[model samples]
Target: MIFIIDSLNLREHEPLVKDMFRLRKRVFADRLGWDVRVSQGMERDRFDDLDPAHVISVDDEGRVVGCMRLLQTTGPHMLSDVFGAILDGEPPLRSATCWEATRFCVDTEVLTGGRASNSISYVTSEVMIGAFEFAMSAGVTDAVAVIDPVMDRVLKRSGNAPHGYLGTPKPMGKVTALAALMDCSEERVARIRAFSGIDHDVMQPHRVTA
Candidate 1:
């Protein structure tokens, strides 16, 4: 499973990005009835656009299975405007060098049994871990992850402790709610890569240090 990591804003990647939104709607808005984002039909905003964001995940055969996004606050991000309510007193932007992790969704099409752990949930976990590594290699010092209970656990276990975590983890699918931050670390990056489930034999050595 050779996952692709692209800038996401590129024209060639449009379809992949679109599928990502569709999946988000299915999981968050349509199925769970988060309706809050139903009007958009697709859950996307400024942070998903003009912001410095990256889309890293896998497209098995043709369908999108695993997906996650990275946002650098050095520019602009959803934390500043979109879902400000979740932050309470916490600053939306952590630092000039800090970034935010957002819009993470994994497709349900993957087969049984996850990559690393015995639990199937590790499939999604592997993707997020990969995203963390990608963020670090991209030059992120600190990262704020908008998360809930499930994800907060993963983020805290991201190897290196990030710099932001405030309030409780409520439920908000793609509306950009709840946040946790961590400083980027090489160790974390490698751990995430190994967790990517790329079958160590094929994972490009340069792309993953672990």
Candidate 2:
């Protein structure tokens, strides 16, 4: 199952949020070797305090298996505040309808031996669907993601490729990162669901306010 959580209400979902942060620490800080802040084995930053909406995937045991963060572009986001170098001299994007999707990761440790561990598994697509649905619910029309080439290719191979790109690809820590823009629409959501064989609604009743 998936849950959409508002940062303000994160304490209400403590266990899920803790698992998500630990998963991020593994993916970003330990595995990916990004220069991010970590405390008590959890990776987090200032944006987290800004109350970005989070879309999370949980297993039958109620543990976080995958997660993604969404921040309104009009406010302070990674692309604008931290990863300006990825923009390659282009001005930062700030718009009410465009939100930034960051901290996207999955629990690779647990998904190493199943169909869910594949390149385009239900876990990945389900979170993508959840992100789009959550954004649309909040009146966002587009999403920009700062991703490495691996994730970029994953998006393309899964048939959810970005509709536009914002910056040139450049080295960021251990990986080369770029900014890609994807539309927040039902069409994209349908494509992801069809590819992942997920026929039911992935969105939970919980939602975040912008």
Candidate 3:
């Protein structure tokens, strides 16, 4: 399927953003029992209001399948401001061009399976490309994602391998992040597209007889 990347400002995206948050609460707070503070039936935080944050994701027939949050570095991200305590009380971020990518999640029920499923797991391609486009247009050069180890594998395969950025994986205790910078190479961009296609090809089976 041809997945389009839609980036909307809060005023323009209130509805979709609302849906995204509801899905987040359903998955992160309600389903996974994360102790996220609730407000107006949506989970929110202080950082949510700051940094002219950008929301990028795949719109699958009006449902948000994959999503990621990008916070431009006007102020310190969790890595610089919050994660330090766990990472020896020191910030790992090294560039003002960095934008933090967070809340990267895929709707599990709609996710593909085995090889076919693995194919579409690259859904983040469009989202990342969209985010990267936004950054490049805004004259940005660096990016970061604070993520879990498993999720880190996805980033690594996508060519965002994080070895020369700022730090290495550590015993983060409760701390977590994909935590890597953006690499704007033609090959990297191509990989993002290739994988996104593998992840989001429109063709699907015509029947389900179960």
Candidate 4:
């Protein structure tokens, strides 16, 4: 299942949050070899301090299997702060209805046994469903992500292709990154669900209590 976690209520879900960070470290640093900040085995950075919302996918045992970060476009975000080069000469997209999605990672070891193709596709679509659900609830119209060409193909092949793109692709780290935007609508979510055979709500009930 998936959990929609925001910074305001993160304290109650400390364990899950920690697992998300560790999972990120494994994917971004250990596996992808991206230049990211890692401390004490957790991959996090200043953007994490911005209190963005997160869509986290966990197994039945509550182990984090996938996760992504969402931040308002009007605020400090990866596209503006870290990936400005991907935007080319265009101004960074800024709109209340558009939110930036970043730090997308999945724990393949836990979710997929030996990089099984089916498992990879399912986990990818599952987390995307979580993203659209959260964006709709928050009144966001667009979900933008800075992703590599490989991820772009994965999204397209999974039936959740970006509705638009911000700028041309540029080399980032070991891969080429570009800004892709997906519409935040029920119709789009339904398409992905139909493709992945996930016909239920992806969001897990919030057990966090203030």
Cα displacement (Å) at residue 121, model 3? 1.4
For residues 1-210, could you state the per-residue lDDT of candidate 2 as single tens digits? Answer: 778888567779988888889999999998788899999989989999898888899876777889999888888889887889888777799999999999887777776533452322668888898888878877889999988888888788777999988879888678888889999999999888776778887766554534
TM-score of 2: 0.93
lDDT of each: 0.56, 0.83, 0.56, 0.83
Q: Per-residue error at 162 for model 2, in Å?
A: 0.9
Ranking by TM-score: 2, 4, 3, 1
**Candidate no. 1 TM-score:** 0.71
> If scored against the real structure, what TM-score would every candidate get?
0.71, 0.93, 0.73, 0.92
Residue 123's lDDT in candidate 4: 77
User: In candidate 4, what are the lDDT values of residues 1-210, reduced to their tens digit?
Assistant: 888788877887899999999999998888777889999999999998988888888877767888999899998888887788888866798899999999887777766632232377777888898888778777888889988787899899878999889878987667777889899898999889888888876777763221
**Model 4 segments beyond 4 Å from truth?**
113-118, 207-210
Residue 114 lDDT, candidate 1, scale 0-100: 43
Question: Residue 14 in model 2: shift from native, Å?
Answer: 1.2
Q: Cα RMSD (Å) between model 1 and the true structure?
A: 4.6
TM-score attained by model 4: 0.92
Lowest summed-lDDT stretch of 10 residues in model 1? 201-210
Expressed as tens digits, the lDDT of each residue in 1-210 for candidate 3 is 212223333564567677676666665566555446677777666666664454435444677666666665557566666545435555565566666776666666666743343333555555566555556555666677766666667767765565444455554434343356665444565677675554332322221111
Q: What is residue 33's positional error in candidate 2, in angstroms?
A: 0.7
Question: Cα RMSD for candidate 3?
Answer: 7.4
As for TM-score, the candidate ahead, 1 or 3, is 3
